[model samples]
Target: MRHDPLFERLWDGTAQMEEWTAAVSHGAITHVADNIITVHTTYFCGSVTAIRTSEGLVLIDTAKPETAKQTLDVIRSWDDSPIHTVIFTHGHIDHTSGITVIDQEADARGLARPRIVAHRNVKRRMERYEASHGYNSIAQSQQFNKPGYIYPIGQRRPDAVYDDTLSLSVGGERIELFHGRGETDDATFVWLPERRVLASGDFVIWVFPNAGNPRKVQRYAADWATALRRMEALAPAVLIPGHGPVVFGEERAAEMLRHGAEALEHLVRETLALLNRGASLDAVLHAVKVPEAYLGKPYLAAKYDDPEFLVRGIYHFYAGWFDGDAAHLKPPRTADLASELAALAGGAEKLAERATHLSEAGNFRLAVQLVEFASAAAPDDRAIQAIRAAVLRKSIENENSLMGKAFLAVYAREAEQRSKG
Candidate 1:
């Protein structure tokens, strides 16, 4: 019961990317023009867009509640004009939860309430969050390392919603909202015709399209790419993503969207081909890769979501958990497998020792895992303390990838429970 060695490798790959992630988040939007404004939101996330003559004060996605407030605070410093309209590029909590702040500000100023808009699926998404609050919270906590997903549910519904495409003049600016799929079911990208500015949500992360969030539900990579190509066709001068900094020029923006979309489409198409060939799930996951050239591109980095994770998502949709091999329908229990592996490695003590050294080598994730297996094998062993301590140190060191950081944080938390017992 060695388990899939690839799974172990996935664990390592996930760990090794932490340093790369840290270096990437450092990219920032330092300045914005008179027509453009950048909001350094508290979701600890950032978003930017240009206010157009047609639209008084147009906004991309609103950050988390606190961050939304911070953004609004910054906006007040500028032209206190009411937001002509607000767009929720997707249903992520950070982007969708701040309508009330805008509503309140508009009310105080007696300015026309800004129109809230998004893809048609946005309402259902917001409702799902309302209904499954606890489930979302737990999943989010694991991914973002947040204390809890509990937040005051804001009753904000998009004032205007559309299915495929919606075009209008807000504050006299011609804006368009087009639907596509990538990170979430209810996702869309907005384009400002005159300004040549595009506000693409998670569809285009500065790095990779967050096409595969293991913790989230279904994602559509094909449509995601289609959406990107559509935007690239528009030839936007400025590109404002859901997260990270803005793309500087029209040609630059087009290239970024084109590559990001290519990365998504490439993974999806490659994944589908493997699925069509009846390849095992593991084979598909291992086979799909966004060319090294794409990975090395300045805009297409691994700061937000990596491509491999998205590849796994496409594979999962085509085929369930089974590897297409009947033997794996119900493999032996994970704990039982761990026990057998532990015995082979000279019992739990040896595994724990090895894991510690791996942690020292900056392989914090592998270290925690080996420690986990060893601890599972012999809960009462004294090495458990040292093993748990190594996990603590590693988690602390992981600041790059949110999930990698969360991995260690969660493990340390669980280890504490073991200690208490």
Candidate 2:
């Protein structure tokens, strides 16, 4: 099967700038196969797949509100299908938040309201999003590197929710929805055996599987690997992921899925081995490594969630919050701890100076820690705040994953603001 030019660019890693620009503007949509289309945008924020059926259309993972309008326009251009059904591959805003746009489009076209389908736990996920609106808003703002940008709270409730799996006959096409826990507990992967196409949602994104987002809720790496293996067994000819380009050809699709599963399996197994041996969290993080086989795969790059973060997440899932460190069992106030550390180092100024030296030596991780101590020890000190901001900015520059960069940028910007004050 011939791949789209955009897909080729994405697969070869030559379209990063174009992808970013398209995400901010109108993302480019291409026909991956007969009646199957994919919209590629910013990997984390927007990317969706659409399938044209005899009845109307089946959409897997609608893009977010930012690019929803453009996504709708692209779908309309392909065919005036009335969007007979919409499926939320997961509850992530990027995948589910854009249903309203499609709903409105269907209404405008005088078509019946599209039935939204998803796993039943999606409703609970949305409810949790609403419950932790403020906290999520802050975290996403940092995660996306958009200060003060509010996370979308409104969600289009699923019209039909299922537990394990659901088989639907829409427009004479056999659609299968299978539940899998990976990035979110309510994740779903849609398989069209007749079309030989698989919509993988976030389970097999181009980047390393996001089984271990440090700041997010629990992610199930073990279950995630199981789902990937299940999908691999189906031998789909084409794979459309939640993020990144579509995978064409049965050989390529299987390779991507199997390797993605292997990456997660390596992390989970290694992390568990260390934990079982009573290793500390830090030790487990350093011990678990991505297999050499996956290191060279374009689809398995650590541009999003790296192996260390995934290991930490697996550790958290298996163990409790405590890292088996007794001193942290009942830690002193951060300010009090910083004060004592400052006194031992002579003063807050000394800590700040040492942090600056570390930053200069390209030891950003330790520099950030030392600066945090300085900031806490001298909350009102502009000099300490300045040092912290500088160190954080350097950390952000050196980071590869968008999540890490966004978080560091948010902190650096905050420190800069505090210094100004």
Instruction: Give candidate 1's error at residue 93 in angstroms.
Output: 2.4
Give the true-structure RMSD of model 1: 8.3
Candidate models: Cα lDDT each? 0.70, 0.84
Looking at model 2, residue 263 earns an lDDT score of 80
Per-model RMSD to reference: 8.3, 2.0
Candidate 1, which segments miss by more than 4 Å at Cα?
1-36, 41-43, 46-56, 110-112, 149-152, 325-327, 339-347, 350-370, 379-382, 388-400
Question: Can you write out model 1's per-residue Cα lDDT over 1-421, one digit (the tens) per residue?
Answer: 1213432332234433334334334322224444667564421463645364444788777667656676676666765666887888877767766677878888888888877888888889878878888887787787777766574565588888898898977656677888887677788888777677778877766556667776778887777888889889999877776765555677667778888777777787888888898898778767888798888775566655656777777787777766687758878876787799888998878888888888778886578778888877877665575577666767567654455566557767766666666
> So what's the TM-score on candidate 1?
0.81
**lDDT, residue 281, model 1:** 78
Judged by whole-model lDDT over C-alpha atoms, candidate 2 comes out at 0.84
Across residues 1-421, which tens digit of lDDT does each residue of candidate 2 receive? 6776656776676766346446535566757677888876566655677788899888887888887887888777787768888899999888887888887877777778889999999999999999999999988777777778788887779999999999999888789999999999999999998888898988987778888787799999999999999999999998888776677799999999898888888888888888999999978877789876796677887887867788888898999799888878898999999999999999998998999899889998889999999999998888789889988888878888877887788778878988998
| All candidates: TM-score | 0.81, 0.95
Quickly count the clashes in candidate 1: 9
